[model samples]
Target chain A: MCATCGCSGNEHKLTAFLAMKKPEALTGLTVATLPPGARPGVQSFAPDTPVKTVIELERDILEKNNRMAERNRGFFEARNILAINLVSSPGSGKTALLERTLADLGARRQFFVVEGDQQTARDAERIAAGGAPVVQINTGKGCHLEAHMVHQAIRQLQPTTDSIVFIENVGNLVCPSMFDLGEGRRVIVISVTEGEDKPVKYPDMFRSAQLCVINKVDLLPYLKFDVQALKEYARQVNPQINFIEVSATSGQGMETWYAWLGL
Target chain B: MHELSIIQSILEATTNAVQQNGKPGTVETIEIEIGELAGIEWSTLEFLWPAAVGDTLLADATLQVRWVPGKAVCSDCSSSFDVRRLYDPCPGCGSHLLQITQGEELRIKSLTLVDKPTVAKAPLRWN
Candidate 1:
């Protein structure tokens, strides 16, 4: 079982790949000694070696995920749906912010949520309480939600056209930034308690995000978190990233967030 | 960590490549390119490489990685520079508006497969 999420660790096993392996034939193979300090992109083999064949494959490692993400993008565009991916570290208040948004704008807008967590359907339950259809994806041992996962969730939710879909990705600062879920906008949330240097520490997440939501502003006075420094640091990484400060509990800056959402 | 997942993807891609080549005996070497800004830690990837490929076809494969440096062009000044971090600013105008020209590459460049040798035919005995 996974120590972090309390689920079996084989959730992400690609069965097709596993099944493709043939029994090993370990006989009659000549092992050549490679030159010391040989590197890729440099010629390391002799042309006369008839036993070896080099296959050139300039393939992207994330090509499969990228293609799936593009398909999801096309699906969302054809239906005129706006999909937003919410990403952040654990306890950055992504679900809380979504709850406030669904509660405040449910009457004015059609909202659907695809909540992602390593375990439990608690976030989905909270989203359902707000009257918007929701689908919960338990990633098991998977650290981040990939495009195919989101595609499956979208299918299960069956959100209507001209609606908004919020994909609350598994709360991770690093891994989730590597996978694109075909969201129209990627938002990174940071709370006052997490400190101002988060952007610099996790530049990849900050750089990929289009918007930065500074949560828990009500506790700003109690902590020494410098909001300006955080914005400056975030801008240093991503100059075009927008910011919205809010306290979901007190509804401090929910209006600005709503306006940013155009709801 | 995510490096394990990345390695899994690498193994899967390599496995598919081998299958496409009519099930080459074994992967001898796998060449890959990883950019400086690909959001991967080299140490972490290297650390997890052994165990991730232990049971796969790549278990005995020589893993070769080509490191690509991050490069970006300043949108404001049209100046190009090598980037070490995402927060790097334009040297010409000190502006943060920059367009990434290169880096962020995570690719499998090539694979070398060794075919098993055929059994030697016995010379006909002359009586």
Candidate 2:
């Protein structure tokens, strides 16, 4: 209906802009090679030919994702499934904690893990060793997995009645906080090796998380990490956050971690 | 990272809309309204759209993303300010308990396409 008012014509005239196809659906990464254009009748603004003021982005990039996420949440709710998203910096032992969790809970309950990373099926393999259905989402260059991405990955994952799906998001504390993968609980994992200042440094990640996992507790003796300070700062940012301190390697503190997972 | 899949959902929705409207010869552009605090990354969405479209019916379609600002209502002063600026404590009084109203909607508002000009008593060209 030419809703851009008449701005489409202006976009067509951009300097040697490569012809592009608008996507009907997207997965990992979706890039638009062109810029927005202003059209008449419609108030949609467009980039000028040579110069223009900074475009004020009025679109919420996550809108479509939330729709699919809502659908997913509904599906999970109908089946009484609990989905937990695990976020952390690299080597915070997300997989390890998950592995321990599955080991402790698999006999009593069913659990699955959907691993997201820029590369590698390694985490998936590790979880598979933990005796659970595992799905790996290789984002390539992407830092987080959107709901649609998880939706597709869920198909490959073996579904169970009242299942718990733990999504190990990409090894980033920043970008993953921006995207919602339709999980009920968001758990941020941090390791003592990364130092205690992480919670203060990455407040957004901690603020967005419903739970905080401090992994590699056994190594506390070797490092200069202050567990007490980290916990305090994390509490300051998120007062009601659930904290779990564990050593996924030595198996110490795993019982409490499992308890926190409600396993 | 996640935007490509979102674009896919938009495509699926629009394609259904277009088909229901009687398959148009070509699809032009899709207009969507995105609000802040929707927790989506615009740069990533724009960065991953081409791959999502590829050479489908939307191969030539345009993705117009409009950013919607988040309005925060100060619990103390009952004033509204932009949340992105982290408008500390309402200008009237210092209060951090702000309630965010609106600015979380992500939806397809409408679409644009070129069809045979509607004319009465004029020969209709299938082209």
Candidate 3:
């Protein structure tokens, strides 16, 4: 319908739509990053904020993310897929272990890969090429992936008999340990490239990990990583943690690792 | 890092609250209190908020944070003391057998949205 005597509304609309661009990045949010300043305890914005104002909303928005994770866990439980979350630094052989597991049990069991990275889809691409269904989630400038991200990624993946969903979290030794991704097991993978003191330095990551993977044993001879000392430090943090020494490149101890996964 | 997902959660809860309260329009602000030990970066949440709740009720809402420090209690003395995330041991007794008393909480206390009933300027009626 033309208003004002003669213009094609469709053309005008199309032109407007074509000219539309992505939203300009937000400003004024920089102030939000700072800690709350004490001001007799009231943080009133420019205008009156409606909805319950009797008290400060001491809420964690991640609550719903956690709930969604539980639902995903239930879904996995129903299908008998032991969802395992693997967190580690980059090049800790998280994908290498996956590749070997896929090679060993590709025909025997079902598996899927949920790869998370700040950028690049190479890991997911590799996992998918290894005969396992994989979904790549790019977290761009983000440090870690949460359970809800895994839930969203898993929804698109095809499920199969005795399936396993391995959520390879972003390479982070700090923040990833905090968020529970509804995994049956949280496996922390570390390579010899990182010092043996890593377990001691980053205890929270190792303490919460259900299993610790000491990967890249083939390079152990090439490096000075103390295997026994690393194991002892992990033991000090977590009295009882299942761990294994493996070389994904040489296929030295991958069988034991896979056996633990019941693959 | 996963604040994008967290933003989605805020939107869902805000939407439900809106339906219950019968409010309309975008959420101007959604406040949340995160424990220091909750391991969430305030900057990260702010960064991901827009992306996660894109054009939703909470799209432009401010994520107000309340930082609550962690506390641990002594099993021997039953006394509670402040605790740090990276370190172990109690500040009161210097004992490592302390249990977490508070500060590892990840819960939504409440949300703030525009109430339509209030906005329409209906006369206040006493019950």
Instruction: Give candidate 2's whole-model lDDT.
Output: 0.70
lDDT of 3 by residue, B60-96 (tens): 6676666778887766678888877534655666555
Docking class of 2: incorrect
Candidate 1 error regions (>4 Å): A1-50, B117-127
Error of 3 at A105 (Å): 2.7
- Give the candidate number with the greatest lDDT: 1
> Which of the two candidates, 2 or 3, achieves a greater DockQ against the reference?
3
Q: Give the TM-score of chain A in candidate 3.
A: 0.77
Ranked by lDDT, the better of candidates 1 and 3 is 1
Candidate 3 residue runs with Cα over 4 Å from true position = A1-60, A200-204, A232-237, B2-19, B23-31, B42-65, B73-81, B90-99, B111-127
lDDT for each of the candidates? 0.86, 0.70, 0.71
For model 1, what is the alpha-carbon lDDT of residue A86? 95
**How far out, in Å, is residue B73 in model 2?**
3.5
TM-score of each: 0.84, 0.64, 0.68
Please provide, for model 3 over A203-229, each residue's C-alpha lDDT reduced to its tens digit, 9 standing for 90 to 100: 668878889988989987788888888
